[model samples]
Target: MSSTELQDRNVAWFTERPDDSQLSADARHLLESYSRIPADDVVEHVIKVRNQAWTIFPYPCIGQFRFLDMSMKYTKEYPELLERLAKGQRLLDMACCFGQEIRQLVADGAPPENIFGCDLREEYVELGYQLFRDHDRLKSRFLTADIFDESSPLVKLQGTFDVVYTGSFFHLFDYANQVKVSTAVAKLLRPEKGSMILGRQIGAVNAATHDHKTNPTGKMYRHNPGSFQEMWKKIGEDLGVSFSVDATLHELARDHFRFHTDDTRRIHFVIRRE
Candidate 1:
């Protein structure tokens, strides 16, 4: 699709929202935890913030309220992960649109000082402070910089994080740009054995680059478990760092906007520095 067509589609999607009754369990929990109170007011607040964010970037996660579903919360390793974070292990939420995951981390008792969020758009980062209503209380830092720009301020974060979480991020680019992103993430992670990257994104049963309206080149790579593993293997080889990728593909919920076709699944991945 052309750039104009993509923009029009985004505009259309921006106006869509789930009804108040449709709010996910996680969304409700977060609203109460953050004192967004009087259930009715919380629902309105979520709709307004989400609609505004959709205008900025019409990501499916934003459109479907998936941002409230913290990826780490569902992981089998959550107990251990929370323990480590509370003990001061550093975490970076890459391309963290609105820093939802970071806020969830704070809600779960992770030390705010040890959490960080980075995204290319400063607007999104700024909005996060408002959405979570924690600008003053939350100690986590939010950086604005392009991940693909080697000289961008993001480079200052190299080798700084113990865990990097990237949700609905990597699949936005083609294979080449995905490698660039993975390489950048690899650099940001600690060299210690346990440092890793984890998140979920749209994946395909048969991995391949497909036409995507968001890309200038009109293409984005979708991966299955094996292909995702291989992509990380190649990144490790190029960086001369040992790493292992464990990925799983699961059927997306029927209500998910991305579940338009049977070929699409949600890919959950963990790339560990070995």
Candidate 2:
């Protein structure tokens, strides 16, 4: 659909439109091939017909529907995070889906050059960078990197950031993978000086034991946030990192989006090195 249509429906409004008139012959060929389908068909095909696209859209990707409101709520509740940015702290936006946090931080006075965002899906990252690259407020860089891949571009990076943030990415993996990711994040930070904020989905039960829900394409993923925290703590111990529970959003607010399960609640934690 058109950008206006997506925006009206509360979806990620595509700000970058490939200009057919400006394209060279090769570029035009690619554009024609890619945009062959009607706008509405493109949206429906990706959002409903494709499996991976289904999981990434309108949900964790924050591509549409009340995402902007939730982004504002998170920064509002965690003023400390914003204050840290004012102090020249470098920030890492890990698993940053649509780069809303990066945009928000820059808008809130963060030096864009000091901020970096990484996501596994290049499509999302490329779209974000293209749409947000020209903002006068941000000097930050966005990269398409996989957090779970040890040898991915994210792992190859050299410097430690003052703040590393991930929103609702931890619960997507299994317990063992969660532990691995927690340890990796710790290792990426400097001991004691680095702070990590996680917007997590927690359940009262272990994630593995919870009912498996299928995406539109039938891929089963775990959504146990409570058991997640307990297992994550043990994982931190094993990795020699000390993480503390910072805050919890008890699902009492209707403004919060349903990330995993409609019954699922949230926990926000600020972790530091032991």
- RMSD of each predicted structure: 2.3, 10.9
TM-score each candidate. 0.92, 0.64
Clashing pairs in 1: none
Q: Which candidate comes out best when scored by TM-score? A: 1
Q: Candidate 2: lDDT of 176?
A: 60
Give per-residue CA lDDT, model 2, range 84-177, as digits (tens).
7777776787877657567766655666777888877777665554333343434577777666676787776634676777776665555566
Candidate lDDT scores, in order, read 0.79, 0.51
lDDT of candidate model 2 versus the reference: 0.51
Q: Model 2 off-target regions past 4 Å?
A: 1-66, 70-77, 130-138, 202-229, 247-249, 252-262
TM match of model 1 to true structure: 0.92
Cα lDDT for residue 134, candidate 2: 42
Estimate candidate 1's RMSD in Å.
2.3
